[model samples]
Target: MMPGRNLRKPAPPAAPAEREVAVECALQLRRIGDKWDLRQRILNFLAKLFFPET
Candidate 1:
């Protein structure tokens, strides 16, 4: 392995339920005019959901 490279295994695929939730969130965000604030909020929410222990 190359030095400083991440050796951890790749993350598992997202569950169907998680995909559905992501799609719903995307649709909701699309309806809003401005997405500057919503973008970060969405990322934080998804990160929390996918990495609850972190």
Candidate 2:
């Protein structure tokens, strides 16, 4: 069986004064199935290996 993928919908940029509300909206998305469980260290290693910014 194939792995189940979670799709995240992108939200439009919020007004400059509504930063807290924008973050709350993103957290709500994580409570749904839009968040992944990958470890940060792994992602950091992969980024250093594949994306060395000169």
Candidate 3:
């Protein structure tokens, strides 16, 4: 091996490209909807099923 010489040189930097912008539409959702609590309840049920004693 050469003294203090790097085996692999660094790669060349990439050129910048034009980026696309997307327009998003928003909708108002209620906090008390049934879908909000669904994820937590599913996770709890899975944990209970997998680890009962814990």
Give each model's clash number. 0, 0, 0
Q: Give the Cα RMSD of candidate 3.
A: 10.4
Using lDDT as the measure, which candidate wins? 1
When 1 and 3 are scored with lDDT, the better candidate is 1
The TM-score, computed over Cα atoms with residue i paired to residue i, of candidate 2 is 0.31
| Reference-based TM-score of each model | 0.45, 0.31, 0.38
Off by over 4 Å in 1: 34-54
Model 2, runs deviating above 4 Å = 1-17, 34-54
lDDT of 2 at 38: 46
Candidate 2 positional error at 10, Å: 19
Tens digits of per-residue lDDT for model 1 on 1-54? Answer: 898898899989999999999999988887673576688789999999999999
The local lDDT score (0 to 100) that residue 34 gets in candidate 1 is 56
Q: Tens digit of lDDT per residue, candidate 2, span 1-54?
A: 357977778899878769988888888888664334346567788999999992
Residue 35 of candidate 2: its Cα lDDT?
Answer: 35
lDDT of 1 at 24: 95
Ranking by lDDT: 1, 2, 3
Candidate 3 lDDT, 3-40, residue by residue in tens? 99979988775444311111111122334445668878
Computed on alpha carbons, the lDDT of every model, listed in order, comes to: 0.88, 0.74, 0.61
Return the lDDT, model 1, position 19.
Answer: 93
